[model samples]
Target: MSNILRIATFNVHKGLSTFNARFSLHDQRELLRKLHADIVFLQEVQDEHAKHSKRFSPFPLNGQLEFLADAVWPNYSYGKNSVYPAGHHGNAVLSKFPIINTENRDISAHSVEQRGMLHCEISIPGWDQTLHCICVHLGLFARWRTKQLQEVKRFIEDHVPADSPLIIAGDFNDWSLNAGRSFAESLHLREVFEHSHGKPAQSFPSWLPILRLDRIYTRGFSIRHVEVHTGPTWLKVSDHAVLTATLAHQTA
Candidate 1:
């Protein structure tokens, strides 16, 4: 039997439905639990929001990331990229294994966009090597995104070991499809859907996904299966569909 790892990536839209019409953090938590992913990459995670805590009926006092991680994911790390009066939001990584180390690198292209990449070194049980995970939320502008992509590549090269397993997942906002080519050439990482289905999965506008905004890129793992969670039930949670993949550890 192959050693399998299931992972998921999602832009939770700060735990709200499309247009901020509803507070769906509770619903989002339930949906994530169903995935049963060993590691989850999340973008636009609301680390803190005083207003929402007051307005929403069951807002988690600790924070959105902690609330979602709950008991399922005992080890988690959050990187706050954007800050405001109400609170702040950013990217997060939830892991079933122990997180030995973590860092939040600021990759914001300019003052207007507060972007970041969260890197976590996970200690998988009985494994000889640590698994490197990066949770990212890039800028919207094409130029800014290009710059941020390069930064991510550089970060990986400087920090992550060349032979270690790596997974970078999140919302790239790269509708132009440039990120896929760049990462393939630079980091030698393959997007899960692209490797399995010939192209990245469409994950934006959950109700009728037409844009490929979310992605899960991997190295040193063989993808066994990939899925894009859509339809009515998923749409009620966030604007971007949840992307999940099952991978087999490549033993040398």
Candidate 2:
């Protein structure tokens, strides 16, 4: 059995291209399949959008999480953060392993921006300990994001074990790099890109990524490789490019 795990995170922009001109969930699904990630953390996933279904003939009858998961990732969980008359959207996690439990926590600092953390406890076939995965989407403002980070810390302290394997991935919206330091100091977790290459990966504006907006942080795992997928296809798929990391459990 392989001990190494492949993980990825992406903000799908609600299955639409920049400015909502291109509605192409199929393209996003195809690109995700090519990544072959064992675990995927998604932000801006549409749980239900009645209007979109009517507008786009190809929109899956099921939610975007189910459509993207397909057959590869059978176990998945979605957290609804923002709700409207049309529908709701939020964070989602798709895992190849069994998801034993899940919870969606509303972490929004204010009413203006709805955000959430989709926490999932997963059991690998042969692993002795369960893994905790949190798919996060923080606020746009620094102060609000700081508050949300504290909430995240509190959530972990209250629910997750200290020594358990933990993975947190998604769009942080912290372009100033403040969140990284906070997480490192509080949770003792290492960001995958920083651990691998000494700095966070820039993943915003997929076409010409210049902002470090997405990230993956882990505890009890050693980073082997980290990549920020870009180029034409990735650019067209979503406004934010995909972030991937290869990691293995630390030897005892």
Candidate 3:
């Protein structure tokens, strides 16, 4: 077996244009299809939107996660973090392999800014250990993010095996790079872009990305390639560009 995996993380901004001028879930789905990632971690995924459901003629009855997954990714999990009378939005993970277990943990620092982590244990046919993928969307404030990071650390220590192949990805919203050191030290994981290029990729404000607010971190894998999508097609899809990486599983 190749022992190679292509993964991507994207914050879809709830499938809207820069200022909610347009709805582009259909276009976004097409772009995701082209990535052909083995696994995809998504933030700001809309689980339900009563207004949108009625406004958009083609809105999927199931959910945005299901619509995006379509027929390609057979296994998908969603975590509803923020809920309102209109609808709810959160994180999601779509996998080509079988997802044996899934959990959504609420790690919100405060009730005002809801947040959660979507964890999935995927069974790769020939792999010795299960692949643990966590889709995270942290808070915007530095103080809240600090506490959320701690929660994430505890989640790993309590559930994921230390030596397993693990991927932690999504919109970190840590523009100052404040959490990088702590995460790397505690998780023993490396951010794909930083590991590959000595610096994290600028992924916010897709049209002219100049903020590193998104990330893809991995443990027990060697980064083969990494990049940020910032072209016109990406800009039209969401406010935050997609971060992609190819990881090679390290031998024991």
Candidate with best lDDT: 1
Ranked by lDDT from best down, the candidates are 1, 2, 3
Each model's TM-score, in the order given?
Answer: 0.98, 0.97, 0.97
lDDT of 3 at 116: 97
lDDT of 1 by residue, 46-127 (tens): 9899989899888888899989999999999999999999999999999999999999999999999999999999999767
Model 1 residue pairs with clashes: none
Which ranges of candidate 2 are over 4 A from the true structure? none
lDDT of 3 by residue, 57-167 (tens): 688898899999999999999999999999999999999999999999999999889999999999988899999999999998999999999999999999999999999
Write down the lDDT of every candidate, Cα atoms only: 0.91, 0.90, 0.90
Model 1 spans > 4 angstroms off: none
Residue 212 displacement in candidate 2 (angstroms): 0.4
Candidate 1 residue 37 Cα shift, in angstroms, is 0.6
Error of 2 at 72 (Å): 1.0
Model 2 steric clash pairs? none
Give the Å shift of residue 175 in candidate 1: 0.9
**Model 3: CA > 4 A from native:** none
How well does candidate 3 match the true structure in TM-score terms? 0.97
